[model samples]
Target: MTGVQKLENSKRNKIQAYDLAIHDWYQFILGYPPHLVRHYIEKFGVSKYDIVFDPFCGTGTTPVEALKNGISSYGLEANPIATFASKVKTYTDYDPDLLLEYLAYIRRSMESSYSNYGIVEPQADLFSYKARFCTIKVKDIINLTESQLQVIPKGFISPKPLLKVLIIKEIIRSIENKDARDFFLLALAKFIVKEAGNVRFGPEVGRTKPKSDIESIHSFTTIAEIMINDVQKTKLTGQAQIMQGDARSLDKYMTRELVRGINCVITSPPYPNEKDYTRSTRLESVLLDFIRNKRELRGIKENLLRSNSRNVFVSDNDSRYISSFSSITSIAQEVENRRLALNKTSGFERHYNKIILHYFGGLYRHLKTLRPYLARNCKLAYVVGDQMSFFRVLIPTAELLGEIAESLGYRIKEIELWRTRAATATKMQINENVLILEKK
Candidate 1:
């Protein structure tokens, strides 16, 4: 079979057991599968002597996959929570039995404390203002400060379950083993999104069925058990240099000497689909203290690539980077023209064109900055989806990004169709492409 045929077959088949190790610890809502990363790793000829870099490593899939193959890698993530998760998931050397023991101790302590405090499960009431107003005492549990509470959506987490989660977090914090504690937190973050929080993702951030109460300890322990099993089976080796910083300024985080050794890059950056990447991880981010206030949340959003109108700020000037590209400018103008003809003038609707420009511009800047870091003949695969979110104006993301890279003197190897998704408005299947490039 051809390499692409094998990759497509892997995606079609069921997820394998070996693929579910640390890679499944706490993934993004719509992250590419580990087999995809492995396909590119093999195709790029990565080895322990070479280095792979993922500039927008959300949840660390590339790093985990690279480390699993014993390849030295580097991952740069803008989100603090995601950066922490990637680092913990890639780092090894913890005994599975010890991790399980720590989980047992934490669960026991949390349950004992809950029993002592006489904390009962809150009733699920859809319209009980009284129940909502009722505050549970958390003197024995770790209570969130007013600022932290303000950042979380009111109905997403009920009071009783929130208290239990806080207690479990405190237990995780008390662990002396740094690696164990970090792994525990990553598991907790996953449990919070999957089981604890009332949020649901139809691949977008929205409320589904409200969860009034959850057995936080049970949920946390269940995920931890899965993690321990994965640890026991997987022998993690190789170095992963992780950083939390902006991708546009690649040189700031990766030194010139380090960049000269980078041989390959396999990453899936945010597409211009109008989906705010920040909102998908908002609940866990706030609960885990990665974002404590509006200011911090705003700061995090600012560092991200400007792909959505929600994150566009007055200070954004990334469009200047792509000002010379007539095709990008015309695309942005067409989006604005379409919006004006449709008479859609909501705040976000007005900036659809600007979002496209800035999205490509930010990507252009990253590519230009990245040019200095890539070694000669380094192969890079960027997985991006064609977007039609802005009023059915089809955005050929992969093609445009390839153009930007070519303009920077890189060789465009080929654009491969990775997958397809049906666009709701346009009723057309948009392709998610793998744009392969090689440094000259």
Candidate 2:
């Protein structure tokens, strides 16, 4: 009934998008809702003097939105695949001249090799996809030689990452036959795994697709066809600066000049007992050489919220929570406490008890630390959803965050519940709530 409640209610409404897909360079992997990004900026009254930050900058959605409105922005994320996609989306200050020239050269190169690339289809079924996408296409990726690839030109100042980009780019661009709608491009750009032997696009809902399906079409040809079409048609517009780095230690990657005092923080840490980002993005890491093997990818603690994964360091604060839980119960509590203490540093196995304590404790530290860096009257927001861990209700996200933010001297203005799109199953469901905080 009050003004505050009314405002929160309106913010909870599902967004309505406008405009048709027009841009070609706009691609996204794990893209955020554009209107939601716009909504935050508009409501917060962000200015040029303010800098925006997303500590868990998955795909750089927040940073890109900030930049589009002429606000300088910075993002921090650890996942290599996510980092790459964010970089592409946020680097709006690109050399359009370079882009245009590259596009021309790519077209010519693909045009020249049409016949050679398009040979007998190893499987007739995929030919439909290829034919549907291209007038001239490569039916078999295994047949191509190093000589054929030599013309593409590598060396983009990156070591292995450049080659990965080129391959994905060439594949997508050479096969696009559509009029280049934004949605289609986005779908393709996010389809890097389409060619991998283990890749699957996953279900449109909570991301559950059979592993066999991913293995079915995962060859060089099908992957390239999907990507090439997606890239060629995607249209991206706006300003952004999506740098790849760690939020926990931004000072390490950012020089003295680049790191800015952030005005707002909005992120969703991985669920406490759910999958890890590094493991989830395993396909990308291996294909791109970011990680050597599955073992290498495990426990890559860059910026995944301390709250979500069991793989967090056990701090003295964590001990206090475990001690509290243990005082109330015995067996499960003891097991959880031991697991938490075992991984005293960070990056541990997924523990039910420790994850609860870890989530709250980590978020508290994140907010408490941000106190000195945020601008005056700046707003902070977090998207979170709580689950019943051990039949004990845990809505510690908002309450704990509010307490910590207050301790750090920020005002806990509101906790807005925004109904988000989630899947049927509890594991993969997307439950997003917006917790708004402000600096005095």
Candidate 3:
């Protein structure tokens, strides 16, 4: 298909009935659809016996899709909550019937316990509860550490739902089976994000509405049931391994045994936008003890690919990797020039140019790390988008990354347009394309 045709096809087939299996568990609002991953997997000629790798596997779309197709795959994600979600979503060893039975036991125990505490069961239609703040007094509910409480924004989760969630968390933790505990916690995480929290993703994480008291028990049970049903339907023979580590340094996670086996890579790395990837999972991450303090939050941000100005620090030297690439340098300079012309003097505005440099540099470092792992004929596909976030200075991200890959001894096979999104700042259409490459 032509590039435009391919883009149209991708948009048309973004979601299908078949995609609702394992991918619907916990997904980002702007996560690329399962069909896109499958398209690249098929295009790369990856077979069941071959191994595929996703260096920036956000929510395990690529790896889960790979396993569904009977192909073994490996994934790397920097965010702990995302990593946990990816690992749990792809895990198929949980017996669906046993999971349901466990859910029943937990529900009964929780209900009985809450009854003794004089807490009524959440009504089925309790989703419409719009109390200003949870007036229901909760006593002896599991409490977050002062540090953990500080991580969550004020009013993110109100008293009643928070109490219920804490109770569920405590109950889930007491489960002896590691898999069952993870499954239950994962379900709870989904509940927190989808129902309990007032957070919304307008393609960015923010609070759009007020939610005082959520139907916590009802929502959790409903989600757990859906997960149980999904687990029963998903039958797979291939393995999906997810590593919670930075993609910039694959050596820390990619083992020698996995290196020589990987023949294809399909991933969508972060683009040079001021989007804090960590914030998207902050609610679950902090609640689940992934990040409890400013120090821990900063530490997690440090491990991610530097795509935004928010995470840029004085110690970051990824820009050195692209010093010799005039294409990247030119973009950085252009962004700075635009900033100067626009008279933008904010600290973040000043670092827009630097963020562009660091973003590509991080990707370059990551690609360089992959060189030692990929086979001679390994095919790779990077789903990236153009950016005009920096004072309307357009960033040709896919083209520039393709050039960088070529410089790193990879041959550019094609740059196929996958889709387009309107830049919120520029009101211009930004191309989201797949940069196809092959190791020489």
Candidate 4:
């Protein structure tokens, strides 16, 4: 491939090695890469004086990149765990010495906890035969409440790993410094999903072979040291503020000083599909106390863009915003028609049509809510993909989103193709495009 072609391919979704300092602390599996954000930041001539914003800031990829480039940015995320991560990753005022001190304290506390359970100093690999034979009383293990247990998918974590994680979590909580505690917690979150938890992401949250036990302390400290080193080497140039709120009503979270202040926007909102965005972070969310019960889970979903069958609620009226747009309504109708034709009668299958309408409608609401806050001629890039997840019906997400933005008085600049992926059901390639827009 030519150099330009190779560059485009690399920028599609892969995070470059040099960009891992803060971006890799914790991230969503489907989040757009930092290079993609840099592409738009440069394309729009975003500078230190300009403010960048990401409404659907999953794990702060845009905000973290913006800060790295010395551009002040703001991000709004509906998921609490993502909001927490964005705040932690973009924060630059941490003391490495203090972090190390906290780490030592945490290690000592963990070692003591292990000894109480009859595990000795220099804890062996929990998965080892002798280690596996080591036993702890059931009452000593930290257990989730029935409601918390119900929220996480069955088999997402085994008992031993969960016990070790909870032990570390308790030790981390005893630290007095909030930032230090959060820094440690973020590292633990990574260890949970990547090491301790039985979850795997093939782009969809699913189970892997269960890990009988894990060397939790070692794994957590290793992740923590990497994060601490990144903080030590990187200079925090730009400012970032991440808030947990629905994107559709951004005005609720905006400050008076930021009114009409945003010069550029870059983000990847959830696409209309069967994949529940919450499931990807369910283990962390519940484990971290961001979500505790069915009620709390519903509350988080209600604040997000209705992009999947799982979050489409009867009380939702986002579809009413696009009542006159036949192009979008037709797609929703077709999905429903396909569902009926195929005799798909499950509860989730029944909501396929609504997911399309609600998804686009939610974006429309977001763009409309964001207009008054954007500076004149502000450029926006939404990284979204086409999907055929529902009964083999295609949803041109970027195209339809552009149409919605236009009706809300934004000008459609261009729809740039980022990459294409095979549809899960049909295995046919589908485009993931960056829908560029400008405030008129």
The whole-model C-alpha lDDT of candidate 1 against the native structure comes to 0.82
Candidate 1 lDDT, tens digit per residue, 184-231?
Answer: 988889988888888887757887677777766556767899889898
Q: Pick out the ten consecutive residues of candidate 3 with the lowest summed lDDT.
A: 128-137
- Model 3 C-alpha lDDT per residue in residues 248-294, reported as the tens digit of each score: 88888987669666889999998888898888888888888889898
lDDT string for model 4 (12-104, tens) is 577878889989999899898788888888888999999999999989999999988999899999999999999999887999998887877
Q: Give residue 146's error in model 1 in angstroms.
A: 3.3
User: Each prediction's Cα lDDT score?
Assistant: 0.82, 0.48, 0.82, 0.86
Which should have the higher TM-score, number 3 or number 4? 4
The most accurate candidate by lDDT is 4
Residue 300, candidate 4: alpha-carbon lDDT:
96
Clashing pairs in 4: none
Stretch of 10 with least lDDT, candidate 2? 19-28
Per-residue accuracy of model 2 over 69-117 as CA lDDT, tens digit each: 6776777777766666566555443344433343343333433334344
Candidate 2 Cα misplacement greater than 4 A, ranges: 1-31, 95-101, 107-189, 194-243, 250-260, 294-296, 307-350, 389-393, 420-431
**Candidate 3: stretches off by over 4 Å:** 1-14, 122-141
Model 1 segments beyond 4 Å from truth? Answer: 2-4, 7-17, 120-137
Best by TM-score: 4
Collision count for each candidate, in order? 0, 18, 0, 0
**Model 4 compared with the native: what TM-score?**
0.94
- lDDT winner between 3 and 4, please give it: 4
